[model samples]
Target: MRIYVNEIKITDDSIKCYTEESTEGLQEAGQMLVDSDNYSFAYILDNGQSYSYLIFVQETWSMLHENKGKKIIINDNLELEQFESEFNYILDNIQGNLNYGKEFVSVVEDTFELE
Candidate 1:
């Protein structure tokens, strides 16, 4: 599967993320909203399942401090363990931004296949 980050909207109160996936075909995958200062991230999956969580960043206070928080959106219809595993895999493999103090945010186009 190929994941494409389509757009990112940054605002004072929240950060809204939009993404597309090219697997069987190109399709909108999901959206994520990170509310400012609260660290609460809400995800609306492609299949319409929703989840929210509080993310704690150990570093990059300068980068994320003003945006409130950030969230990543992936494909839908995954079990919690599957989702967590895939998420960890992405984090482990992706390169970090040197200028942002390890807090990397970008439009990603990468292959990620799940068993």
Candidate 2:
């Protein structure tokens, strides 16, 4: 298992959500979580001492396979750095950020795909 600094190991099957100060939109999205499927999520608070990265499992809830999807890391103040920092993780794959943001920006894309 590839464990991150906070003991968090991410995978393709894993979708990540993030929240930070002044980010009312993601703050609200981060509020809702899984209640009950074929998906699992992990919440990792910032550890200013290290780098960070997040994801929503490309198209797990709102993203498809083409769209960049919503940024896994929404907060601006957060300075997370992943070893693999070239890829952009997203909330969806093909889901347009404008479309999803228009009506459900504050709503988490992957809400209940929990394992």
Name the 10 consecutive residues with the lowest summed lDDT in model 2: 26-35
Off by over 4 Å in 2: 1-38, 46-60, 68-72, 83-115
Give the TM-score (vs. native) of candidate 1: 0.24
lDDT of 1 by residue, 16-61 (tens): 4344542222223334433334322323334335233323232322
How do all models score by TM-score? 0.24, 0.23
- For candidate 2, the TM-score is 0.23
User: What local distance difference test score does each model get?
Assistant: 0.33, 0.30
Clashing pairs in 1: 36-68, 37-68
Model 1 worst lDDT run, 10 consecutive residues = 106-115
Candidate of highest lDDT: 1
